[model samples]
Target: MDQLLAQLPPSVVALLDKWDSNVLLITIASFLAWLVWKVIYNRLEILTQKTRFHWDDLILASVSAPISALIWCWPATISLGFILEDYTQSKLDWLSTLKLMLVIGIFVWITMRLVTNIEDYALTQKNRDETTVQAVAKVARLFFIVIGALTIMQSFGLSLSGLLTFGGVGGLIVGLAAKDLLSNFFGGLMIYFDRPFKVGDWVRSPDREIEGTVERIGWRMTIIRTFDKRPLYVPNSVFSSIVVENPSRMLNRRIYETIGVRYDDSQQVSLIVEDIRSMLESHPDIDAKQTLIVNFNGFGPSSLNIMVYTFTKTVNWVRYHKVKQDVLLKIMQIIDNREAQIAFPTQTIKLDLENAGEFAGMQPQTEHQQ
Candidate 1:
């Protein structure tokens, strides 16, 4: 730059000499940095967005502004160093400290933005579940953060030997600092070992309001998709404290119901029960071996209540419902064969004999006639 300026006319050189060389350098660098920042943020960013790769776009979008700021400050830092060399060592001692702090701080800031970008991008992807994506991203981010920190420290004249000597105490400090994270990590390990549930399992917890299909299980959390199609993010630590019921692993789906017949059909109760038992015994869908029970449980006010307790051969939710419908329709056909009608809710009102004359039009039976 000095040589280039020396070739200029004497008038221009005199004009330029009015300002200190370092200050002039900084001024020129600042203007150049601004132009570069505009091209990067406006032009290059647009170009990156057009690419098919997500990493390319994310890297540019997340780190561009910080990098531009770093560029602007770099020239000033160099000028400051040059000026500090002429001053007393004690007076300019903070320069190295400032550079050290600035570099580390910028790195941390840039890394955080990068991690956040990755997380957001991962969620929009359909190929992987949220739990798995976040798990991999977090682990990678942490690894890079540690490595970057050490690199920055080394660059700032800090020795790795001094850090290694604090290993025992550092471990304790890290454990204490990340107590909840470690708890979740170990909880994830327990899930893998104990195998309470796996991906695609329909799990519900009596302890927590967690009921969903396990989409994916990460190191720190699990992703569940509820019946209503909402995504649920639960920490792995929660599994350790909660009781999860896995219905997907069940051998059969239960079909338990109570059917009633009008009192008029009391004579057909025994026949109906026998027919139902016979039908269940021969039914292909019903598991007759699994403690099947079809009997007249008791008498109700308006009808004889019969209990139907049995399991289906299949555990599939949709198929189980279809099987249940078939069984119920068959029972209806049996009742029709015996000329019995299913009873509905009914009530009786008894009025005083003398007062009954005043309310003569009122029916004694509420839901059904006797």
Candidate 2:
């Protein structure tokens, strides 16, 4: 190792020999880069408080520029190869091999940083979806990985065309072996194009009804966070196949209820219907342009039933519930004011034998007295 170290040229030796060794130069370079990066970062962090454009802030927050500078460390290591190569040709090959690996690693790391930057930028948009952003970012990262792999192979003097051809044939065999996985991957693509539901959407399927906000869209799965703070992960293929009702997409939802009136209070049915229609028309949230209906549904065993139905203009569930509640309270007050009774099941019976026996026992004495 000492001979190997000695074989290096004086210029290389001088740089390496400084202070203690070449390690000190590496330390100095690293410290300088770090110092500049930190200074710039502190300035950016201070400026972030004043700026409204958050993506630029994200660029600083993520330290993308710093990450770039850190990647420069690999090239500095590779530069040693150039200096050492002049000393020994065999050492040159070894350095070259090491340089190739470092280059690929740096490329992948930078690619990941770029993906994160894009994802962060997407998150700042008002209408942008977090799921779609992450999905696309992952796709971009995967693309970079494939390219980096090919480049690494090419750097080693591998046949690019032959490798691609072999990969294509091997990919077919691997794909067939994992058909279900591929189905899910393509299903994710379909979801991106079709857009049946988006982030923060509340959806219900036939077997499961859950109110959730979409968290992420992965190649094989979609993640949702429910109102209860639980995460629900469903496969993309399953989501594509199932029938999902997106409540958030609806402009309005119909409210339906039944109110019962007493059999003796049947005369008030038409009046009640008229009052309900008036109530719906006067209500601020109810959609006046749509049909507001109250009709005599049928007679129950003990009461006359009326069906009341209306639609509210707003899609917000909480607001819709409040409006329906207010309408119900007003209708109950109207029923009370009209002096009509709400009916419940009751039984009436007549007694005949007991009264006859008491009168029969007293009839003979009354006849004698007469």
Candidate 3:
């Protein structure tokens, strides 16, 4: 290789001898590196546009690999000493250090970029479940960071075992600092694997009273959008531990109503219950398969309480409300026709005092002059 290098034309050799110190060489090298990267990356971008695969688009969108390659090639042209070494000892040492830094930078940059590409690809696979994708992405990122850090350390001539020993202590401290965060993370994983609730589920937790649609299942918490347009973020750990009531998942909805009748109107109570049952059975929305129960539940202080239990054909809230409204209107009409009134809580109090007389003889009680 040395003989071949020496055998070149005088002008070419002269140019190479000057290559080490010539500012023009540095500029040309930079321009060529940039030109190569531009051409290759643009071609990738064009290819991405022509293809229909989203994964390919993601790969093209992150052009870090090409950029890393261009960066790695730059110092090789001037720093190998054989290529061009004209500087004094101090300048050469500086150049060497710069080259080493560049090498470390390229190593870390490429590793992270490739990791990003893999994560993007993993996200594109719809066959993989959402929880799997999240876990994979997290694991991939951690792996990339560790590899990058180790590569940089090794480039500086440091042993990885020493770093790992230090890292063990550091990791312990970090774990202690983030105990709750880790708990939430693992809780989220359990929730995902257990399949207790999914996106778009309506869940009610003992700690939280949520009546809304699920918007997202994130790493530490689940987001629910309430009916009032407010967003609630409940920790996944709480959801995993608590009882979750999913109204949407119910097969059929039970409609229970308590209607009261005046105590004196006892004779009409049975007739009203029978009429209500008939109305429920004849209603278009009632599920006939479900057993309907109508009974005199109990007697209140001022009224007879009747329980009407029936199931609606559908579980949708709006439809259930419509059916319930119709039934309620019919019950009111029947009560009006029978001239019976719905009872309210009532109490009568009698005030009697021994010798019921006003203070200081202002007035005196008189029970038929007794």
Pairs that collide in candidate 1 are: none
Top-lDDT structure, candidate number = 1
Write one digit per residue (lDDT tens) for candidate 1, span 1-370.
9889979999887866754545675778688878878875888778877888889888887787778777777667767776777564445666776777677767877887888898898788777555455555667777778877787777778888888778668989999999999999989878776778877789999988899999888888889999999999999999988889999999989999999999889999999999999999999998888989999999898879999999999999999999999999999999999999999889889869987765665555542465
Q: Candidate 3 residues 1-370, lDDT tens each?
A: 7798789998888887877556567657667777787788788888878877776676555555646465546545464554334433333444555566566666556555666676667656776565456556666667767776677677767888898899899989988999878878888778777767666677675555766888777778878998898998877777656777878778888988898999888999999888888888888888867989888899888889989899998888898898888888888898778889888999879866754555426434454357
Error of 1 at 180 (Å): 7.5
Report clash pairs, candidate 3. Answer: none
Compared with the true structure, all predictions reach lDDT values of 0.84, 0.78, 0.75
Q: Looking at candidate 1, what is the lDDT of residue 12?
A: 81
Worst 10 residues of 1 by lDDT: 361-370
Sort the candidates on lDDT, descending order.
1, 2, 3
Off by over 4 Å in 1: 1-21, 82-108, 170-185, 188-238, 246-255, 262-338, 343-370
What global local distance difference test value does model 2 have? 0.78
Residue-level lDDT tens digits of model 2 in 97-120: 666777677668766776787787
